[model samples]
Target: MQQFIVTPEVRFLHVVTEPSLRLAVLEHISAGEQHSDNHAPFFVLETPTWDGEGEWSGRAEELRADYEELRAVLAQDVRGVSLPAIWKAPSGARELTRFCLELSEMLRRLSVSPFDGAVLVLAPVEVREPERWVSELKTLLALEELRKARLMVVEVDGSHSEALAVALAQEALRVDARPDEGQLREDMATMLAGMAAAPAGVTGAQVVGAAGPRGVSPPAKKTQARLSGEQRESLARELKMAPALFDPSFQQALRLKVFAAAHAMREGKSTEAIKGQREARDLCLDAGLNREAVILELVLGGYVLQAKQAPLALEVFCDARKRAEAHELAELAVQAQLSAASTLLMLQRFESAALAYAEAGKLGLVASQPLLAIEGYRMCGQVLARAGNVAEATAAWRKALEVTRSATADERTASSAPEVARQLAALCRKHGLKAQAESLEAQAVALEEPPLRQTQGA
Candidate 1:
């Protein structure tokens, strides 16, 4: 068997099967797809007993005829081929063209599908013309329909299957590099299953533009990573495997431990807190604990803000704010906004902070956190006033006072209104307008209607 990497978007798997051709199919196909996404050509001309469960049995010559029949079906340039079922086929030029054309269409679709996908093709190992497969595939894919796509090709031989197995391990690295947690996990699972059946050794695995650097396995553990027997067993249980099957757990635990080590980096422990937070977030996603993740993100956002990294801090808090809005955590969203605004303030981006604070105030009011609402309102007013928009500032402060008053009943003390009024009064006085300050003070007292009096009779 031989492996070839043609383009980033395309992969070709070539193998030689004499008496039986099932090895190539079993080497690649798994439950990840209803069928393999490899749109490339697979040929098993001479094979027997390829289908164990089905009645699809044929001699080598019969299988070759079947392969040609499939080639005829997909020989069209537009409509694509489904992953071909293993069968016998004799070779022909026209049949190969038809097969390549259809297979080409299938490859084109995989590139743009919503889910990341792959293609697998298996054929009888020996062929009259191996170049025919490659040329036909390239021509079919070069059509306007698939001009910009990527492809990868792998060929296998009995002696090289072992090397192929090691090369297949690179799939883990590809998945691990993905930033999206859900996608990463899905890729990891699929790759693992693929690796489970891939041949153990091959001459070389050519991964086109992808498959990353050749021979790079998942990152090696920096130090001796130890796990208690019980912990190992627990992890195996989570993965739904027996204790004896611990390789996957080792990788998962390493990833988690790397994140955990980040937490106590300063103390020289193995883990990092940021990594832990990220893993926790990923865990939340896996468990469908969205609310928990959102809340945790809010806390993490605050921590970033406190660390005084203004830009990075804003990104975190803004994400939290968006999540809060989605979950209807209006109060929490307001808090996130306030935190973001403060970070902006520290950066001397006063106008931006003022706008953020205004948004926080609005959300706080709607969330019924009147005191916080008022405080935000006051801050925005002050910001506007300092920016020299006296009228807008005054309006903002008045709106803040109204919100505070409306939060209370006549019998309830005017919470925060007095302090706000005094602040407004002083601002008004500073503008050399005693009458406006007096009016504000009067409104504060008058809010209680001065207790209905019997003096009307007098």
Candidate 2:
């Protein structure tokens, strides 16, 4: 059980448990069911105060800060799960909506089990109406990710309103509980069993799930499966459902625009998506989310590229590279350069692409991202070689070789080292660098050849 789980996102539950024993129950859930010896749970427990004169609704950014901080902790633990070799932490600061969307994306991408994770939030229902308050929390607070990846249990002292429970039927479980640790534990065990049996049915007062039996379960993929288009819209729609009250401010408006743009993209409405993203980017700048604003340039560039506006895409990516550099966002800077390089290639500007990739490689090295550095330099050499720039190609490949040497102990090293050496060796031989070519050939062989197997059967 990883700390992160995916099922229904948020569930409101009130069940019997001793005050003394609630902490223990939380710890149990946080640890997750004992799936394996190496399993780690990524649980976040938040207890927010409600003292300020402003409505919790009004403190959107502050609440976002707390949620994102908890998410950042989860992000670190998420790395322990299986992921691509070159994955990194989610990029820098974002507005509340983008932050929540990113957190949801990261959790969904990284989680291995369904609803095996929990977020235990202990706080008073803040708004005048309990239903409205929870709604705001889900949307405004960006706890919306609770639907697909994990169970969010917001425990309150008083009974929740009937209207609220009814409105969230199937999504929440509100139990009439008293202090009985033993009974609570038994119930939880039963609930967890129900969840494992039918994770798709997450929240109910009776059990986690109670469904008719099915055929033999298929083997789960090592990676999270891609959500279908409908599923993606369902996820996006959750964020787009933020309360109308959230629309007054620039930040919230931008949030809606971004969400709309995203859904449009997923629905294959490119024109609308581009228009919405463009508007959202300007709103980000107006709202003072500078890093996010620059990030949107990257997004707009991608959208433009997809729409077959290669020249405009090149311009946008180039602008993004400059913006990222000015903001000192090294990773985004590398991404911008790489994006521009690819766009340049699409436009048959091979020389410019080579220059861009080389620049990205230099930036990647500066950012301590050896994988990106290796990729950029490798591509630079390839593009240069194809264009018949033998000397420049040799220099780029040699630099890539140096980067691989330093990254030898990295997980990506084995796959990368041999390829870089072999390519460099081929180019070296072509250029008549005989001794260098021979040494590179030996290096490539040493890296690629496997140890001999000892066999008894002849």
Candidate 3:
């Protein structure tokens, strides 16, 4: 097999039907011929066979064992902390996105660790959605921490090879497996020369601005004349009264009333907004629209929170949460619990806030919303820290990290656990828990990549 020197900047490589190529790459990385840092971790995601079972299963197990052996060898022989290899089957759609997201998050965490080394990702041959996979890979590449991560895609039976090549043309290079010894040597030497010639500080730029991953464009600025306070009040009154005339049968009218109340609040009419929200909530309840009633209650809770009535907000949010749970509205229940937790925090009920946050996180996890769960745990840590319970705070933060790490295969946490660790570390340092602070700081570093420092030597 031909061997090429692996550079830190090499992000993508495509091998054509060469299973041993992964071993060769690992060997080169372990040798540390092109970099000074220790060999990093390896995470392998193999695509499941078409039937989802059969001979490929045993083959996959064998490959996984081989990867484990390779990891052991690197750890022992090369004196590197080669973390365990992660093997995953090719999950379609949501699963694929989750896989990519998890890998990206892992790479990000690895980048900040003491090792500060590269990661190798071995992809499956028959990627279900090549274009989408490539797109996600591009997104991962755009992440700062994952810049040193490399992807190796092995093409089997020429499956989507051409399409994959085109999609990843800018980021990946084709690797020739059957090259002659002379050709292989030349390839390695050329790669080394290219790495040496490459600029150290090459940066990427965003070509287009977007509001979210779905490519939704930002709303255009409104050019209409702004309504005066009196006009707004008049509109609010009209909306509130309009719902009553139709015997409150139109949910849209009630919704409009809620919107008017929001507008009034934004216009600084807090008293009027509170009154409007109460009236709306009562109307929704009277109409037997429990879901709508819960929403209105949440709005009222927000108004109370804005008015600095933390106690009232807590009550309202708690009621909303109960109503949402009774209605089997998981999303609304999670939101209400989070709102109640915030109110508790505002009121300096630290222990209660922590409990509420934990409850919210549990609800989020049960609802399969990993981001919400992560936020909840993160808040729990903050509240504990504020209450002068460093140990408990650290525990909560660790729980958050665990949740992030063990998030469902289809869930995305957006790296919230690392943020929690970072914040907790800062809090620990502030509180003079030197030993704890150091430990947390190291965990934070392992969980997140700090901004790169400019060293004179480099």
Specify the highest-lDDT model's number.
3
Q: What lDDT score is found at residue 264 in candidate 3?
A: 66
Output the worst ten-in-a-row residue range by lDDT, candidate 3: 202-211
Give me the displacement of residue 40 in model 2, in angstroms: 30
**Of 1 and 2, the candidate ranking higher by lDDT:** 2
Clashes of each: 60, 12, 0
Local lDDT at 260 for model 1? 39
lDDT of each: 0.50, 0.57, 0.59
* Tens-digit lDDT track of model 3 for 1-458: 12222444455666654544645644443343224333454434443333222213222332334344444554564434454455453443233344444445445444433434444444553555555545555665676745666655555434344455566556566754543656655544443333333332211211111112233322434873444556645765777543233331244445446755776676668888898899999887776667778988998999988987788888899999989989798988999999999888888877888999999889988987777888898899878877778888888777777776666533432456645765665566566666785465455434433222111110
Model 2, span 76-115: residue lDDT tens: 6634423322223244333334435544544454355332
For model 3, the local distance difference test gives 0.59
Candidate 2 overall lDDT versus native: 0.57
> Which stretches of candidate 3 lie above 4 Å from their native place?
1-249, 406-415, 424-458
